[model samples]
Target: MSRYTRYGGGDPLAPPVDLAEALDAIGQEVMAGYSPERAMQEFLRRGGRDQAGLDDLARRVAEKRRELLARNNLDGTLQEVRELLDTAVLEERKQLARDVTMDDGDRAFREMQLEGLPPSTAAAVSELASYDWTSQEARAAYEQIKDLLGREVLDQRFAGMKQALENATDEDRAAVNEMLRDLNELLEKHRLGDDTEQEFRDFMDKHGDFFPEDPQTIEELMDALAARSAAAQRMMNSMSAEQRAELMQLSQQAFGSPELMQQLSRMDDNLRALRPGEDWSGSEEFGGDEGLGLGDGTGALQDLADLDALAEQLSQSYGGARMDDVDLDRLARQLGDDAAVDARTLAELERALRESGYLKRGSDGELRLSPRAMRELGKALLRDVATRLTSRQGQRDVRQSGAAGERSGATRQWAFGDTEPWDVPRTIGNAVRRTAGEGGVSGRVRIHVDDIEVQETEARTQAAVALLVDTSFSMAMDGRWVPMKRTALALHSLIRSRFRGDDLQLISFGRAARTMEIEELTALDARWDKGTNLHHALLLANRHFRKHPNAQPVLLVVTDGEPTSHLEPHGEVYFEYPPHPLTIAYAVRELDNAGRLGAQVTFFRLGEDPGLARFVDSMAKRVDGRVVAPELDDLGAAVVGSYLGSRAPSGQADYRDWFGGRGFWAG
Candidate 1:
């Protein structure tokens, strides 16, 4: 082994900042690797370009590939080679049977019709039929697909199976649905997704064919994705729990002290003492039981974008039911007069919940916020911010030097904090290496204008926006909880990472209102005891902005419930479902205050409410705000749009995000 410099891996020795860059520089290396995420992350963690940095990496890779090819006299470039590899020519040859006649020998055969084989299988068979098994193409073309597709799909009923899985015949969908329902019901009863092997076998015996027989865990999902589109799958499976948690915990440990740990310990005790599965914890009233079984209570909304996914994950826990709640309390539930969750798993869940800060007390006697939870929220926001700022969509480059246009007049002589943009490449090289080996830049090294490019800065005013989410029970009426939570997570990510300067605050209202960190938003969907507290939400937002008056203030309200809770003069909380005068009055007052304070209020209503609309219409007249009736998927874009007004020019606002990279997410 000569001194080898390995490059390009999904879990690259050093991951690139951007996926594209990773593909370009170490893509070949990535193809050979087992852990793409690990390789890519590693590549990036080593001073690699983030997603935005990919373009630069791409250019560099192109240059490097060209240089290497010129030195080696290789044809085309590395990418072309990879594309050829993807063709599966060799594997295709092996599956096809060779014919001695000219039709199959000298002449290139047309597409193979494995009358019943899958398209992929048919293609594989065609190759084998086109040449002798001894041919290089046949030898190189591995038997991978056939092993995956199996004889039924390949040798016998390939076409039918493809059509069945593809056309999604009723039987196919039914199978999947039944499996999901079984999982969902189990979750409704238990909190886990697995159980004894025999029980698993029975469930699988019923729905095993719905999914692939092999690779049940999330790991399989990654493999399936990679097999389809190596690049996209690479995107889908960006980080692992181990990596994310590692980074998350490291960051948490750095931020968390003994006080924080104690604060974290209190959440479970409060939850357990409140009676099992009851509204005693005040979570249900707060939209806690939204999509996921946590019910969207103390957890945030961004976590569960898929109720189906949540159900599946929790089905293991759902294997049995707890008798502590009202439903099972009567019979003491069969199975020895108690079907309660086993102490081992219950304690495990409790520990996880507490350590995660969903349940925490710390020095506070009541269930407030946990430091660990707060840290996660902060990290969530940070990750969200990183993604938004690095998003490759709107913005083109990450060259930040404040000024963008001609560098003739605007850029002055080198001044403190003024970046060298004229010769950007050099500027970055210098700046990045400045704090390297020897200490600092030597003034003796004269700088020239060529070494200066006024790093183009997109001029846009920053805004402070607060996303006020409704914690009303109505929003959770149809199990719309998953989408809502995912929306929050995506939005926070869009705002913080993309528009770092823009101030983003999250507030939820049910009985009372509270400002939550980004991490808190993910777990908020489980809050179930819901009644709209629009007034308090607005009031809370108004108060939140008062602390940051200088920033452009805007309120983005996401609600599916009408005003039902509002603060009263008597210091008592009031609740009314259909349009309460006091609630409406309080909501309007808060809006009026926002208008006076020059804040734009935008509402994305999930459900229809005449009173809420009338109130919004009433408030719109006084203040600059917009209302949009939105579905869950549209939340991320809508909030991002509000942040970047419709009339705003090319660079009015920009959100750049680079996701699932390593070290950034590593412990």
Candidate 2:
């Protein structure tokens, strides 16, 4: 065993890493305009810890290996061997022809030596090995071929083996020979079913220095060795018949002995028999420089194949596929432990979001929020608003009250003056039981007036809420777009969930004003139009109030700028910068109309523009409304708090007092 193994205890594997945080971070970056691919790369580059990203690294390693194979000449060594043999044979012929000290017997002997050349390269090499060469150059060339063959063969089995064997001593060569002998013996024993864990351990203990990967089990060792052997076979398969023959002959000269070649051949056969699943017959056609060698080329092709499989597994863009399907072990092998963890985490986050119905792919192959996501996002925003409100109000929980009062949760017989909604299920159930008890009346189950049940509710005033959000280009340019949308969603959620009796209408104004459904409003992207038509927004709010004349009108306006445009008689927008006089007049006229309808108005101004503050303050005063200049972060809370205050017993008076303490609004 190595000294490090003797001194060290095996370190524990790292705990699984969470990828949700990373996914969320990357998603936010993507939403902010970065591409998903680029965002993920940046996340990894910044060392953003997660799971499941090793496929990318594996692809890079595969590419690097390919480049190494393309640039380096692997087959040059074999060519050199053939050239050296040819030179040695040619020099022998020249010596025989030029010998002046030769008699007829010597001439005959030299002629026989020249004529006895073997047809096969291996036999030729063997014959030349035994010959007493007359030329020193021929002898040196033949010897160098043997040394080169040994280094090249070893290099095919192990990376950097050739460089390590450069200028090797006799001791190094002996060690290599011993390693090969022991390796072949282990393979033979394994093939015969006589190999044990202890035997494997003993082999590694004796020759551990040669393998730095330090595989723990015999299986791991076999897998490693089998892959290399298979790749070497594939390398030969990829070469032309002539090239293949030359290489096979040259390999026999490895270590200057046929024994090493025989041992390796047997080992390859044993490995192939034991692990038949390996791609031993696979071959890749490399189209680069002619100097491409068989050593790194096959290994790189194998890596490329692995990378392709990993890439397919890691791709999350396929139809209805989630990240959970990725093979974490393969990912770790390709990238690292951290990448696997990241990928796993990302997969989990996707599964969670998908299963929970927060995100989904649209028909256009783009990710968009589902209806559930919209509701969830709204609730999350509302929670933020509630927390902020509670903090400001000395941690007091805001009392949620409906204008139509709380349900009594009990059923009572319907009366003529009862304004409560009917309990349909209970009423129908009572009618059914009565019909069954009456007996023989089989035509229909008649619901009598006495059987009608109305759910009792406390008496409360109903409210009509209109949320006006500015979606002009400036809102997005000034970075208030998302916050404005969030505020509207929070207020919409607060009313729908806590004040179901109240009617809510969403109005977005940019060059013109229009009403939108809650879903439409939530998913609406910021427009690049150049208008903030508050006049048209208030006009819509007044129309909504008129539709529900009995309900208290609550007009909540969220904007970052003053009115810059107003609707004309022909339905076209007349836009002008620097506060158009007609636009101001049109806006004031709408605010007056809203005031006449008893609309409780609140303007949640987003920025600190002096002109906006002056206009909003004057507008609030003119219409007896509230003007709140809230920081962007507090926009949601401000809107929600205003709606809650408006729903209180004293209505606008209570809202004024609530904001009075916070100094958020001027009457």
Top candidate on lDDT is 2
lDDT of 2 at 436: 91
> Mind giving the per-residue lDDT tens digits that candidate 2 earns over 1-667?
6454331111246444445465555444443444444445455434344332445554555665476456654366555666888888788778777877868687788668767877666667767777888778778778877877787787677655777887777788888888989988888888888989998999999988777768898889888888888878887887778778878876877878777677678778889988999888877665555564445655555565565666666554466555566776766666567656566655655555455554566676655556665565565566567668766743333222122456735455676766668889999899999999989377688899989977654335689999999988898798887677677777877666556788999999988999997656655665788988988888889999999989999889988888999988888889999879999999999999998999889988878889999989998897789998888889888888888777666443222222222222210
The per-prediction tally of clashing pairs is: 112, 14
Q: Per-residue lDDT of 1-667 in model 1, one digit per residue for the tens?
A: 6787533122325321222333333322222221222333333323233232222322433443333223431111122222333455534444344535445633344223222333332333433333343445533433322222221111111112332444334454345435445643433232343444455456556755544524454334223322222211121123333432322232222111223223222322322332243222111111211221111111111111122222232222343322112122211222122212222223233334334433355353433334443334434444544554454365555323234322222222344455545444555555545445346566444444334434334345666778887766666665556556555665665455435666778888877788887544543435567577778788888887898878778788887766778888776788876667778788888888888888877878775667667666666667867888765655555665555563134443333212223324451
- RMSD in Å for all candidates: 28.6, 15.1
